[model samples]
Target chain A: MSAAAVLAVVVGAAAAKGELTGDPKAGEAIYARCFACHALAYNRTGPKHCGLLGRRAGSVAGFEYSAAMKRANWVWNRQTLDRFLADPLKAVPGTTMGYAGVKDRQERADLIAYIEQAGRSEVCRAR
Target chain B: MSSRIQSPDASLSLASDAPNLETRRSFLGKSGLVLSGAAVALLAGRDVLAKGNRPAGSDVNVLNSALGAELEAIAAYQVGAESGLLQKPVLNLAVTFQGHHKEHADVLTKTIIKLGGQPVSAKEKYTFPVETLKTQSDVLRFAAMLEKGAVSAYLGAVPVFENRDLAKAAASILGDEAMHWAILRNALGDAPVPAAFMS
Candidate 1:
C-alpha cells in the first residue's frame, strides 16, 4: 500500500465506529490481500467467497464448521459482518477462520464495501 | 459489476476456459484448513451471538432463507474475482460457478414472490478473513471450505422445502455444489468424494 493510501485509511478509521462509511474502490484493493485463502467462487484454505454476505455463519457446504459457527444465529449483513469482523474471535468464539480480525475502522468499511462489490464483478459472471 | 440486463441462459452455461487456463494436470492444485488454538483455550465453553438462529418457518420463510444464501454466493464470487489472485482457469471456474448461484437465486426469488412472500435482499456487508488471504492457495482453501458448507447446507435444505418441486430444485443445486466441492478437493489433492453420504 502506498503512503497516501495508508494515510487515507488511517484518517478514515478516525471516525466514530458506528458512523463509518466504506469506499468500495479502496476496499477492492484491500481485498487483494484476501486472495490467499479465499476466492469469489471455489473453495480454498477456507470456505468459498461469493455468499459470505447473505447466509448464516456456517451454511456453506463441504467444510467442517465449528460448533460455535453452526450454533450462532448470525445472518451476515453490513452491521452483523461489521461487528463480527471487528473482532471475529470475540464475536464467534470457536470459528475456524483463524486470523486476527481487521482492526482499522475505515479499512473494515472499505473491505465490506468491496465484498459487496465483488459479487457483481464481470469476472464473477464468467459463466 | 454493472447491472446490465442478462438472459437467464447466459449466466448458467459453461463458456470456454479463460486465456490463462492451465493444462489438465496443472489444473489440479487448490486449498486446506486449520483451527486456532486460542479459539479453544483448552477449556472454553460459552456460545456467542444471536442473529442467524432462525428456524425454517413457513414454506415462504424457508425459501427466503435459501434465497439469502444464493445472493451471498453471487457476491462472494464477484469479490473473489476482484482479488486478482486466481489463475485464469480458476477465475473462469469461479465465474461459471457464480453463474450457477445466480440461477439458484433467480429461482428462489421468483418462487418467494410467487408464494406471496417478500424475497430477502442481499445484505449490506459480507466479511472474510482478509488477513489470512495472502496467497492463491489460501483463497482455494477458503473456497473449498465454503463449498463443503454449501453441500451440507443444501442437504439440509432439500429435505425442508414443503413444496416437492422446490425440494427437487434444492437437490439439483446441491449436486452442483457437491461437484464444486469435489473438484476443489481434487485440486487440493484430497479425496474429492470423502464419504458415502454428506454428514
Candidate 2:
C-alpha cells in the first residue's frame, strides 16, 4: 500500500478503535490472499470490497449472493467486520467465501483497517 | 487423498441406500463400516425449492423444509452418538455439528414464525440406514455426505429467495455446512479442499 493509504488507515484505525492500534501496511499484505477473489472496484469470485463498510450484507447489486447473505440484516462496520474477518462461517453462517478466515485478531484488525482505507479511494468511490 | 471419487450426486440423492455411493470404494468403507448415501437425500426434496421458481410456497416453504432437514440431521447425530460405533473424538465432533444444526433449525423456526408461517415440527422418528454403521469411518462418511447436501441445498436456495435477509441466512448456513464437509471429508482421508468453486 502507498504511504498515504497507510497513513489514512492508521488514522482511521485510531479513531475506530479509540486508542487501539493496527498496521494498515501489514493489513495490506494480509489482504493479498483476499485479492485472489475480490477487487477494489469490480466483483470477481467475491463481491468487490470497495465501500464494503456500512453496506448491508448481500446488498451489492448485480452480484449473485447466497440466500443467507441476502437475508443478513446487519451493517458492515469495524466490529462486525472484525468478527467476520476472524471467522466468516461463524460470523455469517452461510457465506460462500471459501477461505477459512484470518484467525489472528491483530491481522484481522489490520486487514479491516486496510480495507476501510482502500474503500475511500476515488476508484472505489466511483463504484 | 483416497481413491474414492467424490460423488456429489449419488451422495446427495438421499432416496435409496444409494448403491452408487456404496460402490465408490471409499477408504472409509474399506477401513471398516460402509456408508449408505441415502441419508443425504433428505435435503433433495422440496426442502430446497427456491422461491423464485415457486413463489406460491416462497420463503416459508424453504424455511420449513430446511427446518425439517435440520431436525433430521440432529436425529442422525443422536443416533450415531448412541450407536457406540464412533470414536470418542468423532462422537464429540458429531455432537458439535448437531448443535450447529440445532442453531440453524432455531433460526429457521423463528424466521418462519416471524413471517406468519407455521414452523415444521421435527419428525418423531427418522429411518436412517443405521444398519450401515459398522465403524467410526462409516459414521463420519455418512455425516460428511449429509453435510455436502446441506451445503448444496442452501447454495441452490440462496438465489431463489425473494427476501434478501433469508438469502443471507441461507448463505450463512452454507458456509458452516461447507466447513463441516471439509472436516469430515478430511477425517475420511480425502483431500478436504478439493475445489475452488463450491458446488
Candidate 3:
C-alpha cells in the first residue's frame, strides 16, 4: 500500500481506539527535525517544551518571544499542537521560529507524542 | 511618484477596521499609569519584574513601534484586498490575514497600556506602493515582502528587551509573522519554508 494509505489506516485505527495513537519511539525519530531549535531542558532557538502541553504562548522564562506570540491567548493542547505542527506560520502569523513545521499528520502526531513523553520524564521534570 | 513614495499622509482610510478612539484613550491612560508606578518603584529601589527590567518608560516605545508595524501591515492588506486583483479565494485569505494583523495591533495596544505607555495611534495616512500593485502577482508579491519585513522587525526587537517576559512576547509575534511570510511565499509558488534556518 502507499504511504498515504498506511497513514490513513493507522490514523483510523488510532481514532477507533479513542486515544492518540502515536508511538513515542517513532516520535523520537521524528523529533530530530525539531531537535535543532528545541530541547527538552532549556530554551534554545525556540523555547523548551519540557512542560509545554498546557503552557500559554510566550510564557517560557528567559525566551525572547515576538510581539505576536507574547500577546497570543493560545494554550498548548493536542488540537492546538496539531494545528501548529501542521503549519507553524498559519497557526501563529508573527512567530519567529524558523521551522516551517511538520507537514505530515502522522509525523506531527508522533512528534507531539514524543514531546509529551519526554517532557514528563524524570530528566525534564528535574529541570 | 516620489511624492507618493515619501508621503506618510496618503489616504489609506481603514478607520472602520482600526481600533476606536475611546479604546486608544483607555490604553494610553492605563499604560501611562503603569509607567508611573514603575518609575516610582525604581525610585524606591525595588525591581519591577513585570516591566521586564527595562527602564521605566522604555517598554512603551518598543510596544508603540510594534503597534506601528502592525498598523502598516493592516494598511497593506487593506489595499491588497480592495485592489480587485485577487480572485475570490485569494481575497478571502487576504481579509483573514488582515484580521490577524488587527488582532496583533489590538494586543500590542493593550500590552503597551498595561506596561504604562500609550499605544501609538494609526497614521493619518500611509505611503503604500500603490503603483506597483497593478496585478494579482504584484499584489501577492508586495504582501509577501511586507510579511518578510515584519518578521525581521520582530526578530530584531525581541532580543533588545531586558525583560525575559517581553522577549518571549516578541518571539511569539515573530513566529506569527514568519508564518505569514511562509504562507505568502507559498501563494507565490515559492517553498513554504525555504530553509532550515529562517534567518
Provide the lDDT at B183 for model 3. 86
Candidate 3 lDDT by residue in tens digits, B72-176: 677668777767898866776676677667767777776676666667676555556476577888998878776776665566565545455565666776787
Residue-by-residue lDDT tens digits, candidate 2, B107-182 = 7776666565678676444545566678999989878877776775676566656665567667878788889989
**Which predicted model would earn the best DockQ?**
1
Which prediction has the highest TM-score against the true structure? 3
lDDT of 1 by residue, B1-199 (tens): 2231212232322334532333431443332232222122111111111222222234555566566666766666666555678776777877767766776777777655655567777655555555566666776776777677666556655554445555666667778778987887776678988879763
Predicted complex 2: DockQ? 0.01
Q: Please list the residue runs of candidate 2 whose C-alpha ends up more than 4 Å from where it truly belongs after superposition.
A: A1-127, B1-57
Ranking by lDDT: 3, 2, 1
Q: After superposition, how far is residue B11 of candidate 1 from its true place, in Å?
A: 9.2
**Looking at every candidate separately, what fraction of the true A–B Cα contacts under 8 Å does it contain?**
0.00, 0.00, 0.00
Candidate order (TM-score): 3, 1, 2
Score candidate 1 by TM-score against the native: 0.46
* Sort by DockQ, top down from the best: 1, 3, 2
- Compute the TM-score of each model's chain A versus the native chain A and list the values: 0.77, 0.81, 0.83
